[model samples]
Target: MGRQRTVNDHGFWHSPLLQQCTTEDKTALLYLLTSPVSNVIGAYPLVPRIAAAEVGWSKDQWLQVIERLRAEDLVWFDPERMFVWVRIWWFHNLASQTMGPKLRTRTLENIRRLPEPWLAPFLADYKARLNEEQRELLNTLLAGEFSENDASVPHGYRIDASSNFSLYNNNANAKPNSNVTPTLEAQAQVPVDKSGIPPESHAQVEAAIANAQRKGIVKADTQAIIAAVAKQYQAGRPPRDAGAYTYSIAQNLASVATEPSPPAPPSESELTAWADLCFCWPTDNPSSFIRVDKAGFCEQVTIENGNARHGYMPLGPSKLLVALREGRLRKISAADFEDLAKGSRP
Candidate 1:
């Protein structure tokens, strides 16, 4: 029996490559994807007549669509064996990939239904086009016969049901908050270091520090180092010696923190004062950015000595500060500051 299929609405509609296809082409493609015969692998038994009937297209129209898809390398067709292989099929259907040895068993069942050689081209195409991880999964799915040396066949490698990380991080390949089950081959890729120790708990960290103090590590700064080391060990970078190694790590943090802090943002009142001193805001035109002296005065400055005058557009205190910082407004000249001081009387 063919495996179940799932089509994501967002992924199907907004796919970059599908955006290139016409509306009619998208509809036809969707039908091919969701049809009964199209299994989890996105390849299935399909002849021209069968496709034409299922898609409600004339044989000629169907051939034209197929030709377009083939040109884009979207779908590959095998005329001799009547097979259809959708390119990059694994990427789309990753949500259904929890199958393990059962997958290999299913392939053996399929071999009897569709002669084994019919699968050769699909498997070869998958290997050449896919990455190592994806290629490994494709091979696993097609491995129908039992192998004494199969890595998954080993009883020890079976997914540990009680492991929280494996359960919560099931879809390691997909985005966060997704339930997509990644292939077993993908899970095998995670770097495992048997020698790496688990992080210390908060109580354990405190206990280690108390122990360090008994060993004459009672300096206040030394205690700070122990705290930082405890944090690192707790965060999965466990050290071989949790009790004594924290001081060196803490000293490193002190050196790292010596970099200068970033400048603070100006207060809202400062922005308001700067605007009141600089611009005659909320202008008559409601559009002109009216430049003003410190005492609420406006200016008509000509551009390039032309009769055409430069006008100030209205900007709130926040936006006016942005203009000043961004250099859209120039700094006041010394002579202009003298004039502004004279006009300061209101």
Candidate 2:
């Protein structure tokens, strides 16, 4: 597919808001605006790891940039749902135009798919930007338009001076308004104590949750997975790497949810032979499979003269047995299996 194009307002550089952003923040914002995952409506799903990879930065670097942008009110990121809303996207792209029926339908679908907390805020912004024709179209398409008086607007919702919508009550001392609606950004900013998570570990858990979603764990299963992690923390038995532990649990849950019946236990005979395993190169872009022939190895491959050779440094037979049971190895018939033991380029 060809690269997608997004509008870049010539006035962007002159904006006062742009002056406040660091070079890194500006780069991150521009990337989000033009990212392939981004759509016409500007709100879209974006995995933190993927975004990091796109910019040739570490995950931490990407998270830091995103957090800064969020603080500056340039974007809203929902770590749990992996969604992003570029705050002023409409101004540069759709504000001056009247959308056709097809575009309007697609836009509505995109809006509906936004994370629950982002829906109202995005709609509010979208409604405010509509041209007369667009507004008329929206009136027909939506049962109730975005409005302060609209029932869909939460009870305490209000638009502040900056035009940001918040759901805090007037009673400042009344237990901090537990009834306030949770937006994705608000949820991300929830206090560590209330969330049962350590202040420093939010990013890790978010990354883990994104990983889980990629591994086929559905949104419905997230609450249960989070509960399991929270229970461990409460019991004072938290894992050394909370993110890794959460990912492992997610993997287990995903496996159970997908596989109706477990495979037969590995036999002793099956455990001894070399298992030929084929995996794709550059995982995300798989043009060819890089086959590993010596499938009995239990440790990292040894490199000699720029070639990979296995079995020189074995962890143990016990680990090998575990790998076999985990379905990580499968025996395959190849005429030159031994010749390819050292993972030669295909």
Candidate 3:
């Protein structure tokens, strides 16, 4: 289900930032704020093309709004990733008035999917601005898990600016005051602590990761899969099941085979020459496996599991010298040698 977002009628109209933008700019900003695609944690994938289509703006017009908003420090955009983040997204939503971590997790899922550089700004904003209750919600978002005990978990909201900063729901159209007001609850740290972990669990988890490395898994790529599970464990999300839970996470890594590097594409001259020599190549263009026979006929051959059919063997540029050293081709006529060098055997 899409998350229910609320906008305050009084607060938004009162906002100086909203007042300064042009009619077109304000509409674009509103669209971005209320976009279904935006995650509550604020960072969202949005390109000029998407914004233009969604907000009824031309390409040039949408870009101008981006430049203006960015100048005001209201939004940050990554052209390379086509991702944009709203600077104050969390501050406005702290009035969610909902209980438990589930609400926070909805937004955090999007944040978790972000790279550090993208998530850092929002996190920094939260750190500098959130009150005690809001901080726990932030922690829950970062933790990516729930407390089994509702009593120990905090129900969250921020105080108005007089207390710290003005807390308002930054929605675009909705006006209903929620049945609940976001607030703070005081409680003990509830999840079973690290003491519940078995003594040998750390060793087992490390060994699992090391074994994966030996099998050629890129440590960097799998870091997310590893860090998330570990963070949850440390936060007391599942203490007694530490070994089994983490092992299950690593098991996923074990199942995936390392992807091989893609072969370099053949250049235009090489392709033309190969076509002239009547050699077949991969239509998808990943790699060409070519073979030469004793008859001085050159053709591209496909091999599977280190074996070939019809007496053809694996022979590419890499294997050419090896084939010669192995005496696979002991004699070559002058004409055949010339044809081979020219890649045009008659």
Candidate 4:
């Protein structure tokens, strides 16, 4: 009795298509072709460790081979997330050959008749290489098999071959509003603290500003900090309120200071003044006044001429308050102030 062959055995030995490939290429090709059927998605089955083990190579050696494959366009690797996708040229060639000359001819002919101009070049090139019978079959297949009118083509009919053409046009004609306002709830949830500062977000802003200073990219100042925060808000950072901005600045500053080459430090007077402002004035009580000392303590004071009226204001307890004052907390609008005051205890 003749030996009964399993699909895997048949695919491995008797597949005429596999005969053309070298042993290593054949293994790689089989791995790729089976991957989709094996339910692999995104980067696929060739993770770094698995790829190394499968190929019986060191991690570094496997990486180099992967790089070479990528450079040849035979494989794709996304290093950031460590994923891979492979394209098996041999499989594509095998499939094309298996369709036979007659079917190829019919598919070409029908592609030529497609009303779309983009398909024209492909049809013309195909027809030039194929025999008359093959061309006829190719056209018939394209028209009857892959045609939008074909019930088998899923969704029944497709007038356009490329989905992107309409997508581009739709996007071009779309209008985006430039001045959309946030809803009250969204605004309220945006990290506005009682003192009108954001909570728990000082680190980011400080880091950004400090980075700019260290790189000699920009000078650190109230305006510079605000500008940095504004840029972040525009770029979709959350908690788009004053307090978050203040916290971000502080965070950024601390981060930049940690680098090997720290930027020049602020003068003693400047530091003292900043400490005073952040601690003296309460963000929640914008109406309340404060005084600051060089030693970083706050003294209560009355506001006069929009400034502390009493003797040199003592430094405050809250470092955040000082940073806020340095950040130049703007006077809240009358309506905003009224809202804030209503929430305050008398």
Candidate 5:
């Protein structure tokens, strides 16, 4: 008599398959498969804090299991790099083998039914790379399952590769109505201006400063201190050297608020602005008044005889700029203009 294969009707992994793994390994694997686990295909690094919370284990226990898994080629940890990598291929293979072909087929069919447009490209690419057996399995699974609802072509079927398909369907039936406007009661409560500064204005300034810090225009410590002071002042507790503090914080906050938020890595808009600024202004002995180009590039020019001169200074490559535009640069490090300048090219 052969051992019967276990299958999970839920389509993910099942308890029966988990029985093959040690208790600790099972716990770790289950945590990795749970929601909030990003980067499913490759190595999944788990932070100690997150692992502790997820598995109700101490840091040492979690580390022990992580080490054991790594030794078994189930996981990998790079302490120096601060990442815990899981071998997804091995885990999936173990599950598939235990669960049998039917479970794998059903799981894949469900994945194909996911309506997100962003996932379409990945699915198409994966389908193209599939072996004949895999393709046949997928087709067979899909054949007897529920048929997909036929969606009508939108009025404007401009194939937007960048547009979010999931968002499209969500907003499809939405319509504007006169009664849809928010009532006065629904509006946010404006705090009274007790500090002689309008509460709204103070909030705006604080928000701007936060935004600047987020965009790498300011440091986290600087932002934290400024925010603390602003909050205090807004609540009627002015700091020492109130005027200077207000001015400094306001200036920093305003700088970011004035600029548009950059999108994605290597933002074309910011780069173009930098390029234009480089070509339009003088960079030699640059002054605070020197206007930056749309892409945030400074131009080169000499001010001879106390008059403004302008010429393009060839721009430099900057990883900071890329990080800033990509929204990955941390707020704490971003406030130091010198740090950002280090990555900027002439």
Candidate 6:
């Protein structure tokens, strides 16, 4: 089956914008709405010729329609970048004022894939359109400033495209130019006196960040770290120890950016204990089990009739051990073996 995309039939035909469009303009709008190159975010890569040809319109005819649409604030196109931003696409499709973290993550992922030119404009549009509550929700989800007009933008970063940092462009690859500039982490090194923190505790805050950096646990900037700590103080839940609190907050922020490392392989006896606890004993008639192989790795295996059918990457026994200790691993069943064999989550 072909991939399917959602089109708000009611919203599209009923929109006041459609009333302003000519028949040709409506056709062009429909093409943009259902275009194969378009994505859920409505911002996507496309050359002018491809769009023009898709609708069986001459290049000039398509450009004329596009110009009319742009004049009415219906769509935005960047000729040099070959990208289009279909205005109000989100309003028509996503519809909801509030976005959950998963949807927000998906939206940001699509936005980041656009040519760099689209980043500021896309954010600016959202900032202008969303209400205070919606903006705060997005900001919290982004975990950084989104305003292009903000002073922080001049410090030489865009959104963190690669996930090392959030809205303040912590991704090392987000450098907009070849000229050398301070990175987000470097900017954080400069102390933030405006964080509403007591001057006396400032040194402690810096020390905590430094300590975390020394331990290779901190991946965020100093300002972000201070902001996190300051939030706690404002909430009337000040930590008993300033340094420890700062370190913990920094660790939490770093945890969001850092990918977790695999646990070390456990002893053979430990794996067996985990397997027994989880009821994954070697029954040899379609079941999922955990076992320690000769390579000293604990692998999750699916077997049927005394033959191994599927296997997952061997993991350290730590997670299984904890699950076993807490009686959390559910009893294995035929359904689990099917899920394991199909590479589906159980």
Candidate 2, run of 10 with poorest lDDT: 156-165
| Per-residue lDDT over 97-167 for candidate 2, one digit per residue giving the tens place of the 0 to 100 score | 43565566677777668776566655555555555566666766766543434424442222210223222
The sequence of per-residue lDDT tens digits that candidate 1 reaches over residues 1-346 is 6645666665566443454577767766777777777765676777777778888877666656765555444566655566666653543564224234556455435433443433444334334334456557755655565332432332222111111111112223433323333322223354322222332222223323333333333344433454566566558777544433543343244423354443344455544565443432233322223344333233433323222345443233445545554556544444544443343312
In lDDT terms, which candidate is top? Answer: 6
| Most TM-score-accurate candidate | 2
RMSD values, in order shown: 21.0, 22.0, 20.3, 23.5, 25.8, 23.9
Task: Name model 5 segments beyond 4 Å from true.
Answer: 1-20, 89-346
Q: How close is candidate 2 to the true structure, as a TM-score?
A: 0.43
- Which candidate, 2 or 6, has the higher lDDT? 6
TM-score of each: 0.35, 0.43, 0.38, 0.20, 0.23, 0.38
For model 6, residues 1-346, the per-residue Cα lDDT tens digits are 4546666665566543355469998888888877888776788877778888889977767776776665444677666666777764654554233255546666767766766655655565454345566666666665653443541234333211122111222224433323333333555555454356754455445545654554456767767788888887889887666666776777778533654664555666665654522236434442556543444454566556655566545545456555545555555655654555466646
TM-score of model 3 (CA atoms): 0.38
Across 247-273, the per-residue lDDT of candidate 4 in tens digits comes to 346345422333344333344676565
* Model 4 TM-score on a 0 to 1 scale: 0.20
Model 5 per-residue lDDT tens digits across residues 206-299:
3333333323434333333345555766687764433334434644443223445543344466666444321211134433222245554544
Report the lDDT of model 2 for residue 333: 34
* Clash totals for all candidate models: 4, 0, 3, 53, 18, 2
Better of 1 and 4 by lDDT: 1
Candidate 3 lDDT by residue in tens digits, 211-284 = 33333332333344356456775676753433334434645534345765544434444444433232323334
- Cα deviation at 151, candidate 5, in Å, is 41
| Clash total of candidate 6 | 2
